[model samples]
Target chain A: MMVRMAATRDGYGDALLELGGNQRVVVLEADLGKSTKSLHFRKQFPQRTISCGIGEQNMFLVGAGLAASGYIPFASTFAIFTERGFEQMRNGIARPNLAVHVCGSHGGTHTGTDGSSAQSIEDLAIYRTLPNVTVLHPCDDVSTKILTKQLVHLNSPSYTRTARNKSPVLYDGREDEIEIGKGVIHRDGNDAAIIACGILVSEALQAAQELSLEGIEVTVIDMHTIKPLDEALVLDVAKKCGKIVTAEDHSIIGGLGGAVSEYLIENYPVPMKRIGVADRFGESGESEEMLNLLGLSAPFIAEAVRKLLNS
Target chain B: MSSIAELEEVARKCRVRIVDMVYNAQAGHPGGSLSEIDILVALYGTTLRVDPKNPSWEDRDRFILSKGHASPGMYAILAEHGFIQEHDLTSYRVLGGKCQGHVDAKWCPGVDFSAGSLGMGLSFGMGSALAARLDGSQRQAYVMLGDGEIQEGSVWEAAMAAVHHELGNLNVILDCNGIQNDDFCDEQMRMFDIPKKWEAFGWNVKIIDGHNMSEILEGLEFLKNSNQKPNILIARTVKGKGVSYMENNPSFHGAAPNDEQYALAMKELGVA
Candidate 1:
């Protein structure tokens, strides 16, 4: 099947432009609007868009302030830069349970050539620790758009990680399959489940396809929502497959893999191998190079699956 | 709408509650609360347009206490204005208490911003002001900051953004109490030319005695009359204004008054 390619950041921007129709929906940017794809909304709805200007800490609280005053505010910056405002996110946004949607684009080591400083290896881990904050890392442009729009009805704070790099458009015509807290399974099998998120979702699908050719059937789950994790689905797969290989372009400490493992260990234990960055920073390179170097590409995911099954 | 004398009397009672709340709770910040009581009393008692019954009413003026450890003052004033019962003050710093050790909007009524970490309320206030403008509401945001709280770089980020956005409806009251938890502001960080610093940030600066009810009212007037830019009233204050032994004492910045000290405070405030 032929696949289209699109960046998740574009989907974030598309969602903002569509949400602009609601008078209560407002956009905030801290001088990285173009990078985070909020410039699209800023240009069209300059009046409702607030330009916070080179201040991420101020941007989060400003978003919170807007949330408190009956406005749905969406703020964005690079993933690594968003960490600069994590305390603000914790105290102002999450503590108050304000409905501020924060999009941290260019997340993970898959963001090309920006080097270690720009690549956010633990954005997911930090945000997951926050109480009353939903954490999301949608796989494709369509899913990003769908999940972001769902935030309008949530009436709570959320942190979404989007990528600057383009990936295979998985949910192009299957928009209805996408939900905020539920995982989307691309290919299903009983051998083992490959639970992944962000850019690794596509890699997990590719690995599952490759494994199928070799008679090792596998389940491919796009575990997009990291917090308020889909424990029901995770437990179902752990029961069916008996073995699991979790993958992501984030740190293994507390990203997608950490969330899944923590849930399974507590509820139902299973033999699992988390395929992710080994708590190391990325160097200046193409996303493909970084993914391969960090053991997060399709082949690496397949190898991990085989290793898990063998174990 | 209260006269200056009526506001002063109300503030004196709040001062009694500020120390009493700390003493009953066995732990709370009384020093900064005593210094900020007069301003909180004047703002909520007379000028701020808020309904205690409808605390979440849209278009109500948003008040953010950035220096939230000084929450005793806010809780006392909130009780005086009926946001909560006077009995709720007993829950200060206690678990399951609406009066959290810090100012939190989720726990308490009429609190617009949940502030505990310093240098945050101004930015939140700016957001509130912007939201009001977008909704075409005439409500303003009042943020109270401490002298030491401005030491955080994020505060400067908000100060710059408020000026850049020309947020005329954003008002700030800095409790220039000179002392922080560890020591005085001069010892911790010399913020020389404090008013000049705000003026440099393009804000309309006003200085007043934060303890004086009439001066605090005048400062509120200055905030109301000023427009087209952010405003800040750099109110000079003592860390522990009402209690003699605690006055200008850094140790009292975050400490609860002992039983003896509490009695002394009540006697000094003429509530004995």
Candidate 2:
């Protein structure tokens, strides 16, 4: 398998430049164009891009207005800064059911040295609670770009979180594999399924490969859309594997783990373990170091899977 | 409704409806509603280029009540402009009612914004203005804000952005009614030299007595003629302008007028 590495933010920028072809697609930036990779689109379409300065709250509503006016507006900022305009997104956009695509770049503890403040471990959780709001956390650049382009056809609002660090391009040439709400099976097995999202998808792949070498064949799923959880896929994996391990770079509570558990408990209860940041804040550190410290690396995922299998 | 007398009569009728809706519902902010009715009446009657038959007309000027709690004023004027019937005013705050407690575009007619929160409409208006500019249309986006509502930090963010974007198509109506939900604007928070603040932000500011129909028309004319920068009409008004007892009274800001007081308010506005 040819492995190419790229940041999901770069994919977001690339997708924006592509979406610029559509006359109605406009980009909004809250002074994070460079960081969120929206600068690429801004450079090409300055008239269509709205520079909102350092006002995330204002940027969100501006996007809502554009959406209301029949224009598809995409706004981007840091993951944590997006939270600053959460209410605006909820009231002005989601309640009105405006199709404003908001991309919160540099999500999760994997965002590294910008520290706990910049690393938004709760964006997915908070956004998932909003009605008519779609939440996404794609694993790699290819997947991110594919999901973002699909937002143009959607008449509802969405919150897509991207990362600052690069991950293995799992869908390098498999552009047909990614969809907004469906999970993609990276590695297939029936022993115990490892469902992960965002940066943790690569880690889950590594974990599955390690377990396969030991003849303990494992399943790896990239559950990108957290809000609209692919219930059929989850139920399928749950029924086949009979055991599940949910992984994410977000908090263990109200994230991918929380979402899966909530659904499985009422519909299909199975033995499960959620691998994530134990309800705690992150600190400034290297990407690999942060994952290792938070016990979110491949070794930790493999360890959890092993423990679940033994139990 | 082009003449001042005709517009004043419209304002008076809307005033009756404003009080009637809040009084009948036994809920809502009647003070700000009464304060803002004159401006709303003027805009819908003489200033705004809108087609009541096509409320969602693509080229129509956008009207956003950023201080959305004062929906009665908006609803009343909307009724006067034939956007909604006076019969629809009966649904104020009712279940499955089009007239939501807060103004909502999705639920109601002639409402461009589905608003409940404060300091949000300006940005939305700015967006609408930008969209108008992008489309090369001559349509304008109008937002109404309360004196107390300016305290929200996000409003400043948008105020700066609107000026920076040079949104000449965006117009703001500041209903300086001097009162908030809790108390007067001075008591709650002193928004010192409000005109200077807007002027400092590089906006085109015009001052007027909000309840004066002729002055409001002049202000509207000024906003319409402005180019190269956004404009704000600072309309100094009395909270509960039509109701004698509720006038300048903090208690009436969020409270409903009693039946007796409602009758008095109706009588004060010369409503049969």
The best candidate by lDDT is 2
lDDT of 2 by residue, A38-154 (tens): 999999999999999999999999998888888999999999999999999899999999999999999999999989999899999999999999999999999999999999998
Give stretches of model 2 more than 4 Å off: none
Given candidate 1, what's the lDDT at residue B177? 94
* Candidate 1, A74-155: lDDT as tens digits: 9999999999999999988888888899999999988989799999989999999999999999999999999999999998
Measured by TM-score, how close is model 1 to the native structure?
Answer: 0.98
Best-performing candidate as measured by DockQ: 1
Clashing pairs in 2: none
Give me the displacement of residue A123 in model 2, in angstroms: 0.3
Docking class of 2: high
Predicted candidate 2 versus true structure: per-residue lDDT over B235-268, tens digit per residue: 9999999789999999999999887887888788
Locate the minimum summed-lDDT window of 10 residues in model 1 chain A. A91-100
Q: Give the TM-score (vs. native) of candidate 2.
A: 0.99
Q: In candidate 2 chain B, what residue range of length 10 has the lowest lDDT sum?
A: B257-266
Report how far off residue B86 is in candidate 1 (Å).
1.6
